[model samples]
Target: MKALPYDELRALYRNFLHSQNISKATINTAYVDTFYLWRKGSKELFWNAVTATDFENEAKNALIKALSENSTGNVSSLVNGYLSHLRRFRLFLASDGTAEPSVLNQGKTANRAYTRKKKMDVDVPYPSIEQVEFYLVKWDGLENYHLQEDALNKLFFELCPKNTDVIDILLKASTLNDFYSTNIFSIYPVAKHICALDIDTRLKAGDVTLVGDIQYVTIGDIEKNFYSFATKYCSHHNPLDYPIYDSYVDEVLRYFRNRDSFSDFQDGDLKDYVNFKGILIDFRAFYGLDKFNLKQIDQYVWQLGKDYFPKNYGKKNRGDK
Candidate 1:
């Protein structure tokens, strides 16, 4: 098969997908636009015009300058994506620098990262009945969607009868860090992506374990669980009207998933591994929201979907949509 120009290839995809009766959505459009732009704007096209040494030298210099200037956030990722796309494009270009191929070669290189699905372990820790009850009792006077507090109380009492105050338990948790401080509620919300957690501790790889769809908690579990929760729940469940965990992550995810329509799930499946980890991680660094308010980050991702996904997903069965 021939390799086509980036614009032409993308335009063809848009047409093909439209022909397939796919619903037009913002997320869909953005993927096509961005991918094409990335391919067109990178140094990959210079491969035939320059030696690998020259190409590498130029790329390294450019990358260094960008990094030294601290041009390192959303713009940086976009730039990287562009460069990567161009590199792939060069592989398809002729040695003479001619665009010989007129269509994407299907049997060529490995599939793109964006097209692949990742699998995550299924277990995570959940609150015990006593802890849930304790939280509810403490949150009793809090108004509005604090109903979550009531839900916690009920679930806890029903699930774990030997209840204790959640606050005290968290405070007493073995892994509390001096660099950061947080309570049980903070951990749960962070895991749920409803908000961000203040964790002073660093995670040892694989220290956090997921079991039977619930995450098992330990001192090192905070970051993984919180990161997973934001990706899964915040982007899909929360409404935009509510506060976000951090703004920029929200912006990039919404820009790509909801606005771009690249995601298969209408709400972009918070429970999906791709959403829960990769997407959120990339967005956190991409938009430079990693150091910002965690609550705000949650708000943005949730809000993106709140305005759109529910209309297509919540009330319908799988076949209904």
Candidate 2:
């Protein structure tokens, strides 16, 4: 694991992120935080020189300081983001001949650090059917409803023309401009990837293919963008067909399952889209949500998340607004 100059490594990582169409603001923040930690230990530390233990320790110490300052909630998110950046950078280095696969594999410490953060109890009451109905009606009655629905449907189908039903439901539910606005470049590529998937055929055979299928959602490490689109798309088209699996939805799942029952299902678990969908399906049945479509159920869960996990679901957060 020979060390490479910190500046050169950072530049390479940043350029990779840029090539992947990551926003400048996000890239800058990740770069600054990553370098800040690198400099804290050694002014001229190299990529291979910093072990996973070192990164983990730095993140844990940062978390401790954040907790002492009563900024754990915000700082936890930042730490997670930094960890993601580090992992991606390590992978980039490995693929580009700058670092060995063994050295890159050593960067797995961040996951442990993330798991150690204080967990929020999301065991809130589920949203009632009346609540979901109320919002659905309100969502439908918004100003220029038809026009907005038309535009959203057009964009969604353009990106994923094969999923007409999903696109139609999405237009009726709400506009997806927020997803498109942020992931303008990645949308088509992701759509193409999804289009090639044989998930529909598998589903027809009563197999849970979505779990293993939808890799395009998080392609290139641009996390959450895929689920964000899928949730809205599937819920709109056929809620029962594809349940949303966004962070808020996961919080709702965690709340219901409780820490003792099942571990928190993170974004990573969604690669197994079948298992992810099954959880929601079983949850719907367990709670007697059979009468409501999966999209409606998602609405209930998402609203519950907003109410109980305000820090994670603050009004300013982007997506499906």
Candidate 3:
């Protein structure tokens, strides 16, 4: 791959700063100037020109020296901002350095990880079966954990380990995140809608449409497609057959597709659970990961996505697009 031009990576850093909630005034006034100075006094292509480890080792001192000589009037803040830019840029690069971070769809924790020279840009080693096992062990080690997502997962299973009724669907919807819950107003009908269907028979049949069927959680006049919520709901019913669809999983799949040509899935196909499952099957077959199940793949990729593509993944209860 060609070395990324200076302007290309700069735009990504700009987006990263936006994600950080920095005001336009600050970005226009401070980030803009610091970036210019960093570009001027710094080496060619800056972070894109070297390994992240190399930057960590030598870039800071190089940055400080460069800024002190060229910048005037309170260089401290600009200097600090540049450093923060580099750190977040690692995250930015890990996600494949899109014009907007969301455009990458997601990648593994290894995407941002430094590699030996001559590797493709943002290229990461796909997890082998052993690596997948490592993540499964990691997941087992975190079982019954009482915090954030794990807390919610534990509460979900504890309340309704089996999806035999309206209450089971409700617990999954409400506890999964604020996106589905959105107060009792949204959660109740979503559960009711799933219960209205012959859930047990559909689950037993391994019906893919059943997931799409449960997703149209209507409230008042508008119909919302809770695609991700639906996958989770069904997966809870039978994790063995149904793999959960998450933004992280989406990103990891997108990354792998680009890196290895594992499947011909477009982004929209992933929103459809059947295609999503098919792609996962293709991924497993291509990588010789058949020894692992879809649920295990879900866990592995989600963890990989968390480490490498963490941007915009914050807040489990985020709304659907």
Per-residue alpha-carbon lDDT of candidate 3 for residues 1-321, written as tens digits (9 for 90 to 100): 125566765575676656643334434433454354346765454644234466654656656676667654234333433554454455555654334433322332323331222112332334566658878888778644224456555655576655558776676777764633333455788878877886877786678888889878779899887787788777766678988787778877887665445677888999888899899888877767788888898888877766655555344332332
* lDDT leaderboard ranking: 3, 2, 1
What tens-digit string does per-residue lDDT give for candidate 2 at 32-107?
5555446554543434333455755655565345433542223432344445445555566546534432343244
Q: Tens-digit lDDT track for model 1 on 57-95?
A: 565345434433543334433344334333433443333
CA lDDT of each prediction against the hidden true structure: 0.33, 0.49, 0.61
Q: Indicate whether candidate 1 or candidate 2 has the larger lDDT.
A: 2
Candidate 1, superposed: residue stretches over 4 Å from native = 1-57, 63-79, 91-287, 302-321
Worst 10 residues of 1 by lDDT: 118-127
TM-score of 1: 0.29
Could you give the candidate ranking by TM-score, starting with the highest? 3, 2, 1
Candidate with top TM-score is 3
